[model samples]
Target: MQKAVQLEVYGRVQGVGFRWMTKLVADKLGIKGTVANQADGSVKIIAIGESATLQQFIGAVKASPSPSGHVTKLIQTELADVSLCRKFSVVG
Candidate 1:
């Protein structure tokens, strides 16, 4: 089933190529939506795709691209549908 997940990834996430890493995973999983840096020094992602795909993407986030940007937390929730995304983007 399709699921929409809102993720808040913490730990030295900003200015660390986090969004690009997220985009790589999302694109590889065929997921779509957006990823960006929050003012609180975390990364936020709104990803929509199959439930299985979402899980896989999350796994990658936990493993982050940089060793320093450890994923301290991940918050996820389901949206009603995937009718809003055009493509995965790194929005400010």
Candidate 2:
């Protein structure tokens, strides 16, 4: 089944290549979405993909993108009727 989710990731996520890593993982998992940095020093990810693949993507993201980065918390919200994109991107 296909699904969509909006995730607000907190802790040491900014300025640490978290968005880039998210994009890489999303792409590898054949997921499409966007990752952006929030002014509150958090990373926001909107992903759409297979139910199982999305879970895997979330796990990979929680692992922290870079050694210098740490994922203190991850808040995920299931989204309905979200705009679907063709690829994953690191947006501002």
Candidate 3:
């Protein structure tokens, strides 16, 4: 089953090429979503894909794709009313 999730990733995520890493991971996973830097020093990701794929995406993200980035916390919320993007991107 397909699903969507809004992820709030905290810690040394901004200015560490986290967004680009996220896009690479998402695209590789065939997930459609958006990754943007939040003002609160967090990275927000909206991911849409198969249930299993989403889980993998989350794990990959948590593993810190960006070598310079550190994820102190990751909060995921299931989203039911989101517009799926055609591909993963690094949005503002």
Candidate 4:
């Protein structure tokens, strides 16, 4: 089933290519949502798609970026953005 998940990755996440790399993951997973840099030095990622795929993408985030990213935390929540769709993007 399709679902939406919002992830907030903190700690040196803003300046890196986090959003673009996340877009790559979402695109590969056939998911939809947006990723952006917040003012609080964090990256906000939102994705909607099959639960399994979403989980896989999350795992990717932890694994691939784990080496360079000192992720202090990864928080996931349900996306309530009604305007969300099936194409991932990088929001300013």
TM-score of each model, paired residue for residue:
0.90, 0.94, 0.95, 0.85
The 0-to-1 C-alpha lDDT of every candidate, in the order given, reads: 0.84, 0.88, 0.92, 0.78
Worst lDDT window (10 residues) for model 4?
62-71
Q: Which stretches of candidate 1 lie over 4 Å from their true place?
A: none
Candidate 2, position 15, lDDT: 84
lDDT of 2 by residue, 1-92 (tens): 88999999999999887888778788889999999999999999999998999899999889986667899999999999545787899899
Order by lDDT, highest first: 3, 2, 1, 4
lDDT of 2 at 24: 78
Best lDDT goes to which candidate?
3
Candidate 4 global TM-score: 0.85
lDDT of 4 by residue, 1-92 (tens): 77888888877676667677778877888878888888888888888888798889888776545345566788888876535775888889
lDDT of 4: 0.78
Q: How far is candidate 4 from the true structure (C-alpha RMSD, Å)?
A: 2.1
Give the true-structure RMSD of model 2: 1.1
Model 3, stretches more than 4 Å misplaced? none
Displacement of the residue 61 alpha carbon in candidate 4, Å: 1.9
